[model samples]
Each structure stands twice: as C-alpha cells, then as structure tokens.
Target: MRPARQTALEKVLPQIAIESPEAALDFPFTPEKVWLEIGFGNGDALAHWHHEFPNTGFIGCEPFINGVSNFCKLVANDDLKNIRIWNDIAQPLMAALPDASIDRVYLLNSDPWPKKRHHRRRVIQQESLDTLWRIMKPGALLILTTDHQSLAEWMLEQTLRHSKFEWTAKCKADWQTPPEGWLTTRYEGKGAVAGRSQVYLTFRKVDCE
Candidate 1:
C-alpha cells in the first residue's frame, strides 16, 4: 500500500469497515437497499455508485491491500457515510450476509485467470454464483463486465447454467454498450484504448421453482 493510502486507511477503516456478519446487518445506516461490489479495483466505480445512491448502503470487498487503502481514501475524502469495506476475500463476507440480503452486485473486469489450469481461480464460477443467488433478493440484479472474450463467455455460461438467474439482454447492443449511468473504470478505459470491446451482462436473480 502507498504511504498516504495506508495512513488514510488507518484513520477511516475503524469507522467504515464491517468487521462481522452482525455488523453487516446494520451497516452504516441500514438503508432500503444494499449493494455489493467484489474486487473493486482502485474503487472508481464503487465511489461513483456510492455518490449516486446516497440512500443505498454499499459493501465493497477487495483482497488487495493497495485497493483497500485507495478505497478507504475515497471514503475519507468524500466523507461517504453509507459505504463499508471488507478488506478480505468476498466468499467469507458473502457467507456472513443473510439470505436475500443484497439488492445489487457488481463484478466488473475481474481477473480473467486466462490459463486453463487457473480457471478455477476465477470468481464467476458455479460456487460463487450459487452463493450470490442465495444472498441476493429475488429480482435483484447482478451486473458483470469483462473485456476478455473468453472470460465474458465463461461468465455467461456459468450464470446461464444456474437456474436462479435470468439474463436481461434482449439484443446484442444491450451487452455491447455499457449500461445507463455506467461508471467507467481505469481498466475499462485501458481496454477501450487497446481496441478491445467489453461486454456488460446483467442477470436477475429469480425464485427457484
């Protein structure tokens, strides 16, 4: 972690970090809705969303220390009151959350883990989706974006294989373009500069019959 960010995290984390499942239940202010962002690299989108939805509480999980520090700096600088941080793996945090707790989730430009042997390390897998399905409220949205073609297909296939989710895209443009009010991240900007297209996929959690 950078020195400045580390210092900022030390000061702000005690106030904004969600330490346990019990804390998450009443995070920040217990707003009408809760959103989760896993692997919020550098926190540009997370901060943007928090700014846009002051009434909704946000829980952002990032295992990388640098990212966590940067995110903490944003929270401190903006004095964003409705956001909480989990500076650890998302699975444990997900497990800590109660059933039907999350209203929205963002998994954007996650590490592709391109190697075949490393595919299991990718976040958009069966187990992760199953947990997400369990925690998400009925009709809640899961928004995923990736510039890697294989990863995009993998996400689509994994989500489609799960019976709990329904794809919201009716046409190509729906996935081709970023969703309305989209907050573009640094990684997304780099992908665009490289002429690589990013896919935006939204899946709605549904009740299982």
Candidate 2:
C-alpha cells in the first residue's frame, strides 16, 4: 500500500470500520437500505455505489489490506458516512447479521480460484448461498459479475440450485447485459481489453411464504 493509503487505513478506518457484525446495520443515520459486497477488490465498485446511493448504507468486506486502505482513503477524501468496512472474510459477518437484514448483495468479479483443486475456495457455494438467503430480505437482489467463464458457470449453477433464489434473467441477453449505469472497475476494464466476456447474474430472494 502507498503511504497515503496506509495513513488512511490507520486514521480513517477507525471512524467507519465495522468492529462487530452484530452492529453492522447501526449506521450513523438510518439508511433507506443496506447493501453488502463480499470481496470488494480495490473498492472501486463499493466506492462508486456509495457515491451513487447516498441513502443506502454499504458494508464492504475485503480480506486484502490494500483494498481496505484504498477504500478508507475514499471515505476520508469524500467524508462519506454511509459506508462501513469489514476487513476480513465475509462469512463471519454474514452469519452474524439478522435475518432479512440486507437489501442487496454484490459479488463482482471476485477471485475465481480457477484451479479445479481450489474450487472449494470459490465464494459461491451451497453453504454461503444458504447464509445469503437467510440474511437478504425477501425480494432482495444478489448481483454477481465475473469475467472468468468457468467461474460464471459455477456461480450460475450454485445460485440456480438454491431453492430460495430465483434467477431474474428471462433470456440470454439478460445475463449478457450489464445492469443500467454499471460502473466498470479497473480490473473489469482490463478483462474487456483482453477480450474476456463478462457475465452479469442477478437472483432475487424468494419470499417462499
């Protein structure tokens, strides 16, 4: 991490860090909604969404210290109040959240762990899906994007088989198209330049009453 970002991590992080998952939703202000982003690499999308949705509280989880530092810098520079950081793996925080707590979740261009032997490390799995379904509000959206073809397929398969989530795509174009006003991250831009196709998947939590 650069000196400035390191300083941001040391100085700014304490003001917005989520020290406890049980109090994750207790923002300074009562936000209209809460969104969680797992593995928010580089914090590009997380920061973008924070600016775009000032009324929505954001919880960004990234195990990487550099990413957390970069995001903290943004928070300090902008004086953003509706954002919180969990600088660790997301599962523990997810488990701690109350049922039907989060309004949406984002898992964008996360580490694919492409090796077959490392597939277990991939974020999209049955147990994680169960946790996500329990935490997200009914009709809440889980939005995921990936430039890796195998990872895209794996995510689709895992999310589709989950009984509590219904894929919102009606046709091929739906998944192929990015959501309106999608913010392309630096990593995603590089993937596009390298001729990699991106897949956008959205699944809605089923009410299942």
Candidate 3:
C-alpha cells in the first residue's frame, strides 16, 4: 500500500505473460495445474495449499510488502519451490494468462472495500468475473472464502449468474465448511476470535456444454 513498495515491484517483478493461469505453469504431461491466490495476506493458506498439492504450480499476488515479507519467511522456512509471486494488481496479471488455462482460483478474505461508493473496488465485480472465467479451464474451480456475510452473498449471487461458472453447493454444509487443509490465515483467526462466521464457496467453470 506504500508508494515506495509499488515502485519496487515495478522494478523487480518479471513480466511473464501467459494469458491464463493454466498457461503460467511450466510443467508438461500432467497438464500442470495453475492455481492463484489473490491478495494473499501473510500467505498462510497459499503455503499450506502448496504443501498439500505439490504438483500444482501456484501464483500468489499481494500488493502489501509486509505481507509479502511474512510469506517470504514461510517460503524460506518451508523450502518451497512450487510458488511464484507478483506484487501488484492481479487483474493485469490475469490479463497475461492464457484462455481456458487456469485450473483453480482462490480469493480468500479480500478487503471488503466496505462503503457503497468504494464497492467498485471489490474484485467480485462483473469485469473481474469475466477476466477470471477467461483464464479458467472448463470445470476448473473458483473458490471464494469470506467472513463478511454481505459480501459473501453478493459474490454468490453475481458469480452464479455467470454462464461460465456453476456454484457447487448441494447442501448447507458445503457453504458452511472450509475446504481441505484450509489452515487459518491471520484474518481467519481474527474472525474466529471475534466469533464471526466464515463461508466457503466453490464454483466450477462451465464451457462447451
């Protein structure tokens, strides 16, 4: 969020243009899956997901330097090699991704951007959804997690209306439960300590019938 940090990212980050998350990965044969975590604050869930799914290549974007440093410490401690970083707005990065390329997408506990006027900044908007769908392979997952009920409902409704995405909740438990190996992030823990509820949403990309 600092001006200096923004300048640093612009200077050091590589511009690997892939056109889709699926295309961002380098492995072959297994159709190497690419999963993205936008605004990975403190990077706990991203780190855990890396260990759990070793074959999956991950791209994590966060504009916050402090959070990036916290994530770097964990990456160093864990000796992880499957993750890459982009310290800027994820939309431009998404633009570089290949169409129908990403296997799964994660947007967990993003800043609510609360005020009605500032809601435009929320990533769950139509433009964001279009960009998200453009990169995801058919049947690929788009996972959203939030403790903010209003935002959660809004995202659910908006994403559900997208012809390319299909929400996968068959029962209440699916909405209430967290995904596998979903380690608590700093925000998630704070919410829990505050007695707030968390919701997990899964949407599959649908294409070509």
- Candidate with best TM-score: 2
Give a tens-digit lDDT track for model 1, residues 33-66.
Answer: 9999999989999988888898898999888888
- TM-score of each candidate structure, all chains considered together: 0.95, 0.96, 0.84
Q: Considering summed lDDT, which 10 consecutive residues are worst modelled in model 2?
A: 71-80
lDDT of 3 by residue, 3-120 (tens): 5544534443333223344444554324267788899988888878878888777888887777776666555545345677776678888887878778889999988877888888
Q: Put down candidate 2 lDDT per residue, 75-154, tens digits, no spaces.
A: 77775689988889999999999999999999999899999999999999999999999999989999999999999999
Instruction: For model 2, give the RMSD to the true fold.
Output: 1.1
Better model by lDDT: candidate 2 vs candidate 3: 2
List, in order, the clash count of every candidate structure.
0, 0, 7
Q: How much lDDT does candidate 3 score?
A: 0.77
Which order, best to worst by lDDT? Answer: 2, 1, 3
Q: Highest lDDT: which candidate?
A: 2
Candidate 1: where is the Cα deviation over 4 Å?
A: none
Deviation of model 2 at 7, angstroms: 1.8
